[model samples]
Target: MVNEMKVAFATEEKNGLDSIVSTKFGRVAYFVIVELDNDKKIKDNYIIVNPGGEARSGAAIKAVQKLLEEKVAVVVAGAFGPNALVALDEMNIKHIVLSGVKVSEALGQITDKL
Candidate 1:
């Protein structure tokens, strides 16, 4: 089940979502967070991400998870490696993969969809 948790949208800039796409370990598609309509409406709440790496799933999840430690939920601009994915799974946080998209545009799209 998803929480009415606060979500984070990764952005390279403080303004709009940037073109930057970096996961801790892999290429980010987008970063987003959903209030979890029982965890099924993730697709509608996910947004684009702005990261600082090439493609490191572990590192990316680590970074995101670090932020998530307090928030409870996150929508990143990309996906995580098997290891990180498992950690999130165990914690019951939905790790939805938003592969290959702009953070700003993705936010608009996902928000509208949601």
Candidate 2:
């Protein structure tokens, strides 16, 4: 049986695999959510607008809540706010920082760590 997990990348645009990693986690425009099999190969992927990006306050916390709802095992971004990092840690979700790269590149670099 194959165990599957989800990894979400905070992205600047909704360009699928080519989406650029966002510089800030809380205010990202979108999230490129990828599903990976036990072999750490991508099984599926999709994008969603970040509601937190439109928030007036506590964007980082709101972003973390959205990730939790998506059942993400790992989150990738250029940087995370202190609140976001702490929330992810408390939720037992792993986070990786890979800035100035496409989602595809980020995935390649992180697969081995999964």
Q: For candidate 1, lDDT tens digit of each residue in 1-114?
A: 344454555444333345443443333333444344544344344443434244454555554554455465545545467766666676665544553556555545555333
TM-score of each: 0.47, 0.95
lDDT of 1 at 44: 40
Q: What alpha-carbon RMSD in Å does predicted model 1 have with respect to the real structure?
A: 6.7
Q: Cα deviation in Å at residue 76, candidate 2?
A: 0.3
Worst 10 residues of 2 by lDDT: 57-66
| Candidate topping lDDT | 2
**What local lDDT score does residue 42 receive in model 2, on the 0 to 100 scale?**
88
The sequence of per-residue lDDT tens digits that candidate 2 reaches over residues 1-114 is: 857999999988889999888888988889999999888888999998888899998888888888899999999998988888898999988999887899999999988888
